[model samples]
Target: MICLYIGTNTGSCGLITAQKDPVPLKSVEVELEVRDHVATVVSTLNYENKEDKPLEAVFVLPLPGDAAVCHFSAQIGQTQIVAEVKEKQKAREEYDDALSSGQQVCLLTESDESPDIFSLCVGSLPPGESASIRLEYVTELAVQADDGLRFCLPAVLNPRYQPQGSAGAGFQVTSVPASLEPYSLSFSARVSSPRPVSKVESNCSLDPLQYLNTDQTQATVKLAAGHKFDRDVELLIYYKDAHQPTAVVEAGQASAEPGSLMGDPVVMVSLYPEFPQSVMSSTASCGEFVFLMDRSGSMGFRIKRRSLQTCIHSAKDTLLLLLKSLPMGCYFNIYSFGSRYEHIFPKSVEYSRQTMEEALKKVKKMKADLGETEILEPLKHIYSQPCILNQPRQLFVLTRGWVKNDKEVIDLVKKNSSSHRCFSFGTGENTSYIFINKISKEGGGHAQFITATDKIQPKVMQSLQFALQPSVIDISVTWDLPKEVSVTVLTPPITSILQGQRSLIYAQLTGQSSEAAEGCVTLKYSLAGHPSENQLHFSLRPAEDTGLTVHMLAARTLIRSLEMEARDNKGERDEEMKKVVEELSIQSGVSSAFTAFIAVSKSSGEAIQGPLIPPPSDFWHISAALLGQAQNYHDIHVCNFLITATESELSVKDPLLQLVSLLEASGCWLLKPALASVLGKTSKEVANLKPASASSEVWATILALIWLHGFKMDAKDEWELLAMKAASWLRAHNATCVTECVEAGNALLGCRVTKDALGL
Candidate 1:
């Protein structure tokens, strides 16, 4: 789909396939500025035409799914042309007309099939001439499981797999390997937060963090000496108090007419709800848990360039932890998909000793042998199943998220959202964040990502806790503004509220108000029949030097809502909604699926007159092969190179996971050899250390709890609930020598945990 056209010296203009020999794009430079949870990114792309004649290059790149592209411009010599947003069809026509008349022009538009993919066309470049294109966009950073705000700049656009007979299936692209890529990248970031900045980490090499202020609230970091476009550029920013609620009121743009989305003031409110301890202490005992796993070839690919561990390996480990942590009396099932789908159970099965063992046995054998990524069919199957009475449905989807049918998949989830909650996990460096985020957002659940540098256990366990929490009801938001002022909410209604989860609300203030006035917004919800409220009172005066990031993000939110409505509406309504979306996109100068940014240069000296250049003889052959195979650039097989563990790796196990694996379905551990092995002792030694009056299962459970509290305290977020389950089981058994067992267990495991700490 991405091609470049270079005219011949003989004045022949023709469509030519992209050849790696002399690509026009030379280098890319990016600057990221983060304020609290929002980020603004500016990128400069340098291009040079080395051919004898004029060149036209088309490149398709990836962006964050939720990014609001706000600026586009091109600099040629002394003149700079700023692009304007227009209806997509009209913009394309204008770009073509300019090209025909030999005036240099450029066009940028979102992909029709996916929001994350964008195409840029630069035409009629003069021979040996250079151009610098500047692009700017704004996006909200995602909060991670470890309280780090995540910002990802996709450096690689992996080929999306289009299923047979799907839309855009024939649009094949030629991708040069990372090693052969003819471009360089440089990235820098500046971060500021209301709370003091704690630290910043990345998977790639980076310069040391430099604090800019006394309070450590502002800092800057950049990529180290040499950088390549081989993988995504990711940053994880930690703050001293990440869970605090905050609000930003940004003044509207001054140049635009009043009453428009861009011209009016906008406020972004961020809330991290904290549930009461009384409600949190009791976990749900009944639910239908369905886990959908992606087994496509891409799953065999490593999560990081330097790591030998593949995505499937980490995913399997996460699944093991999840299965072991489920509460009793719950119903569960597992589904794996590639080109085809398979389920371990014909239907949801109740949680019991036999069922748990059976599922774990089957899970250990799962492999990434499937052909391609096709998730829609399995989702449909899961939705069609009958919901159990009094037991809620909680779906967990794990995948690389590499598919072209993003809209279809998201629409399906939206339609069936009321029946269940969907928690999505994107597990590789090159995941389709748009796909992962949309499904979860629409299904009234949360989305999590697991990269090579991230620990998957904590993230998955957090989602499981969300699944077990009682559903929040009676959700409402109230705004208190000046009598002369009013508001219009741009974000969708709040439906799902979880403990320690950040929820964002964007609203537009249209009416005039005093500069010194203040406004208050309150969020109310009920958990387990208990009412709760959180309110934020912010100044009516707008914040300075915001660069309209909040307004653009708000406009993007409204446009996405309208676009989804257009898809769901009938012919006339759909047309009406499309018009509204296009008008708003153009008014706000934000790029959307229905609109594009176009700029034309009138200073090109002469018209380019040439016949079309013909592509090389091998172009057709290569295109055909890539199209037939779906061209999944990340689809690799896990072979000898990916397995770095020694043959005896199984013998030296993760003591925590080993101890967890020894727990029974009843949440008690038997005094077995595996338990002794996990405790770093022989079975005879452990048996001799047990209290004389304590039962075998009770002693084994106490030892496991002591070891977790003493050694694995760092991973408490992952094992805390399981330990609770074990404690509850021990209390129900009512074994004798309760204090003696605690003392003896601590002595045997070299732990100093008190009986009270275990909630005995």
Candidate 2:
């Protein structure tokens, strides 16, 4: 007989066997197993008594309701039997309750060919022995917004005895909309075993600038993935007028693809405006005139021994033209100066052919005396005369060079702007023409350098025209704009336009206009009759919708205009040029890469070859020719040549030397540097033929020797030879210091000895 002991408890349940009872005793054990999506258990039993006795037992375990029907198998003797049954109805009830409360479901595949379903299983073991069983089934899943519908795949624990445990199965249900067309987007979904999946839809819109100006503008829109997107977009453009329909033009576009590392997209729009062609003309008139000429000792120096005949001829010709063109009511006087001022034309004369002819004859007979050029005394003398101030007057000054008192003359001119316009004519190589030009600008007038005797007539006419043109005598603007609002005029005043010429005023405005009710600008001017004024109204809103983009476009435009104007020689000011150069320099912190200097060449129709090297002989001759044509030969032509020849290797001899001689005879010291640079490197033979110490040539040679010593070149023997020659020449003249010459010679000898020791 066999006896079995059974114990049932909530936490622990088992069967025990009792021994020595004349009956077979048996014990059974059960174990449960659980995985990612399924759970299962197995049972075994053992017999402890020798006498075999029949054993009976019952097994129970929790089951998942969604699981498929449970299958049971038993191995007894050599026979095997399998039974299948549905899971406990109570498990289903529990699952239904949990699902109703928003719990998720897990489903498994019954087999490779089956869909996902619920599954469960149970089995028994023979007495006093161990056996394996198989349970194959599927699981059911629940669906929710967050919890997508899915199934678990069935897996096998023991292939030979227990062929199936649970099959792997998964399905994805998208909670996001399939296509978000209204929002311009699309959606998709996917699943990797054991989890639910979902996705949101998105897309780019075709018409980007839906709200843009329809008549004159169009745009396109694009979409990207990041929180911040950066891309270059294109814009289609059109033009519209109040009376006409819009005309479309295809504009270019840029693209920013997905996953691009660069951030943010930029949109660029271009617009065109219709502008009328500009035509310009000018006329100049003089009511009263004063001619101030420099008659310093230097002027006595002759060009080709003709006493600046070319210059005098040009001046006479210019004066003749002015006198002939002067209205019959006009009057003029002539004043010449050197160490002191003198009245060349003793009294002012009314314009007449006879008067003019006599004045021309008088000018021809005039000669410059050798005296220091002091410009102040003559200018003061004219300024002190109250009779000239009763009516509008003009001052015409001619000079071969600048005096230290130039600033004083400029100041006086500035003070006299109410009654006078001061025009300056720079004549020769030694003259500070640049300074003269600056002074003229400051004095509300113009400056012209006479490059040749021939240029004098045209230049005078131009200067006169500039002086006579009626311009904006004064400009004033009044606006009722919000406090702190800023306004700037974009166009400069046109001073050379005719008194009645129509002109336009353009300005840019910034800041809010709401604070003030209205805004207006007042422009005051002087015309032929009398003073006049004009008014302009300001817009209530800002001129530009996008400040940054407009500013960038403006800057680019300005830069291009500036570069173009810098290369143009027609004497026109391009408002955009300086602003562009300055802005670029400020932003990039770089010095200007190139400096512009006017270079006219013989090859006028073709580009000049080589870098802009200093002017050669051809340049000097051409420049001289231009000057002569202007009738400013004695003064302006020589000045232009000196400035052009400075630091040039070609300036070392011949024409340059001759030019320097002319300048020195005019008492011009400005050309000393160029002469020094040339003579410093010339051979001893060349140095010996140079003028003696008492001559200005000697001063140039001394300065040259000083420069050579300062440079300290490697050719010691060559420098010594030049130095010995200079010393000998200096000793031949009582004008030079022997001690200084000896010191310089000793220094050269020492350098030669040092170089010889170094085998150089």
lDDT of candidates 1 onward, in order? 0.81, 0.35
Per-residue CA lDDT of model 1 for 1-760, tens digit only, reads: 2253222232211223344354667789999999989999999999888776667776666799799999999986566889999988888888877877878888898876677777777777887889999999999999888889999888666546667787546443424334345678889999998889999999788999999999999999999987776777889999997999988899988887788788889999999889999999999989999999999877877777777667777677777778888888999999999989999999999988899899888877888878788899999999999999988999999998887677788889988988899999998787888889889988888899988634777898899999999888899999999998889999989988988989999999998999899999999999999999988899999888787889999999999888878877752337778899999999989988899999998865545455422222223233434343333433222222244432233313467767767778879889999889888889999999887788898998889888888888899998987998898888888877778999998888888899999879
Can you give the TM-score per candidate against the true fold?
0.93, 0.31
Off by over 4 Å in 2: 1-286, 297-310, 388-390, 428-431, 467-472, 477-485, 488-524, 530-760
lDDT of 2 by residue, 494-576 (tens): 33222222233333344433523345555455555455555544434333222222222222333333543554525343445
- Cα lDDT for residue 209, candidate 2: 27
Q: Candidate 1 regions off by >4 Å?
A: 1-22, 170-177, 571-573, 605-653
Q: After superposition, how far is residue 710 of candidate 2 from its true place, in Å?
A: 63
Measured with C-alpha atoms, the lDDT of residue 701 in candidate 2 is 41
The number of clashing residue pairs in each candidate reads: 8, 73
